[model samples]
Target chain A: DVKVTQSSRYLVKRTGEKVFLECVQDMDHENMFWYRQDPGLGLRLIYFSYDVKMKEKGDIPEGYSVSREKKERFSLILESASTNQTSMYLCASRRQGPEQYFGPGTRLTVT
Target chain B: DQQVKQNSPSLSVQEGRISILNCDYTNSMFDYFLWYKKYPAEGPTFLISISSIKDKNEDGRFTVFLNKSAKHLSLHIVPSQPGDSAVYFCAANIIQTGANNLFFGTGTRLTVIP
Candidate 1:
């Protein structure tokens, strides 16, 4: 089975603090993605990596960055968490197909 | 702007009835469509998908119908049980890109009363 796991199910951070969200996929997929789900806004992409050491910015990449040192793992870094950045973060991986498998998602609250 | 849109924010249906969820897209280049189901605090799961070449696709109780001319699509869940209650999201992508990128619409929350 293709399993995607996230580092945290819930997190609390103060303003201006750096936060890191980790995602690991067991299926050795080539593409990984980061997205934030907000009410009314839906799921907006933040970043995606096609391969190790290669990344591309998605529609909403501001205030966020991603790293893919290994094919099985992807990390999303928030330079400085803000109150407006509080939301559920989702990670996904796909293998040369239109369907992308997603992680359970991390719900972050910035105060 | 959102390329894909789910105008309905929520829908309620009784058990053993058909639940139809609608979605629309403004882009004509999208060649593939998919539907995902997400529960609270969990990731969205792939439910069904359809290619542009076909007008309809079905799997068991789930069926997806596409209207290319209207740039619209619908998902029909027959005999929807309470277990089907969740958020349903419809997504689209251009198969030619091969980038695994998808444009998702604002999801519609489904509530099935048993």
Candidate 2:
């Protein structure tokens, strides 16, 4: 079984603060993704890393950045947390196909 | 533009009945589709998948049916249990350029009453 673990299951931050969400996968998958899920908006991709040090912007990447210094870890960074950024964040990893394993999401609250 | 769409926002079914969740896609380039189940406070988990070449794929009590001509797919779960209540999402993928990104639907919340 593949295991994808997120650093924090719940987090709270004040406005204008910096926030980080971490994800690690034991499968050593080459593809890792960060997504924010909101009601009626669906799971919109924020950023994705196909390989170490390589990142690409997804549909909604504004105010967000990603780091993939190692193959097993991926991190999502918020430059300045805002109230609009409060939502459930998900991390996923896949080998080379559509079947992706996901970690238990982190619910971030930006007050 | 929303490439993947799930028209129904929610559905309710009684225990031991069949539950059908539908999904549609506007992108004809997508060659693969998958279904995922998500509970509150948890990430979506892979349920089942079907390739464009095949019309149907089944695993245990879950089955996915795809209609390439209509660019649509459906997931059917028999003997629905109360524990199966969750949001179901449909995703489509195309690997033509080596970038395997999935386009997902808004998701349908299914509730099974005992």
Candidate 3:
């Protein structure tokens, strides 16, 4: 079975504070992705990494950045968190297939 | 632009009946479709999938039916149990876009009453 784990299941941060969400996968998948899910808006892609040093911006990458220094780890960074950035963050990893295994997700609340 | 759409926000079904969840897509480039079930406070889990070449795919109690002409697909769970209740999301895999990102719908929350 494939397992993906996140650093935190719930987080609280103040406005303008820097926040980091970490994701780790044990399947050695090449594709990793970060998505923010909101009610009525669905899950929107924030960023995706195809390799350890390769990354691409997704549809909603405005207030976020990503780091993929290693294959098993993918981290999402919020340079300066805002109240609007509060959302459920999900990390997924896949290997040359359509099926993506996702982590438990981190619910970030920016106050 | 919401390429994948699940118009229904929720569905209710009896424990022994069949639960049908629908999904529609506007992009013709989508060649692969998948269904994912998500529980509260957890990430979406893969349920079943069907490629454009096939019209139907079945996995135990879950069956996926696809209509290429209408660009639509539906997932049916037979003998629905309480454990089957969850938010089901439909996702599409776009081809030739140089990216393998799967576009997802808003999701439909299914409630299976005992």
Candidate 4:
């Protein structure tokens, strides 16, 4: 079974505070992705990693960054949290196919 | 620019009735289409998918229909159950030789009243 897990189910942060979201997948997949889900905007990709220590920006990657030091772990960092950054953050991992398995997701509230 | 669109914000249907969700895409290069179901506070799960080469695919109660000429697709759920209530999202992918990326629509909230 493909199992993906996240660090937190819910979090709260103040403005300018740095926030980190962690994700780990049990399967040794080659691709990982980060996305933010808003009410009207749906799920927009933030960044993706094809391999360890390799990363690429997605459609909405302006205020966020990602780290993939190991094949099993992927991290998303928010440089400075803002109210606009409050949303549901989802982590996904995919093999060489079209199906991407996702974690439970973290709901971040920036105040 | 929104490549994919789900115009309906919400839909309500009664139990045992068929629920139809629609989606449209602007880019003709998208050859693969997918639909996902997401409950509150949980990540979306893969529901079903169809390739551009085919017009329809069905899995039990879930079926997906695609129209290449109209650049549109729809998901039909027969005898909708209360447990099926959730947000549905439509996605399309650009199939490359060894790489693929998905573009998503806004989503439609489906309420199945018992």
TM for every model, in the order presented, reads 0.99, 0.98, 0.98, 0.98
- Model 3 over residues A37-92: C-alpha lDDT tens digits? 99988899999999998999999999899999999999999999999999999999
Q: lDDT tens string, model 4, B1-114?
A: 899999998999999999999999999988899999999999999999999999999999999999999999999999899999999999998775455457899999999999
Cα lDDT listed for each candidate: 0.96, 0.94, 0.95, 0.94
> Across residues A1-111, which tens digit of lDDT does each residue of candidate 1 receive?
899999999999999999999999999899999999999888999999999999999999999988999999999999999999999999999998899999999999999
lDDT of 2 at B84: 95
Instruction: Give the DockQ (2 decimals) of all models.
Output: 0.87, 0.80, 0.79, 0.79
Docking class of 4: medium
**TM-score: model 2 vs. ground truth:** 0.98
Off by over 4 Å in 1: none
* Candidate 4, chain A: TM-score against the reference: 0.99
- Where model 3 places Cα greater than 4 Å from the true spot, the runs are B95-98
Minimum summed lDDT over a 10-residue window in model 3 chain A is located at A93-102
Q: Which regions of candidate 4 fall more than 4 Å away from where they truly are?
A: none
Best by TM-score: 1
State in Å the error of residue B9, model 1.
0.3
Q: Cα deviation in Å at residue B53, candidate 4?
A: 0.7
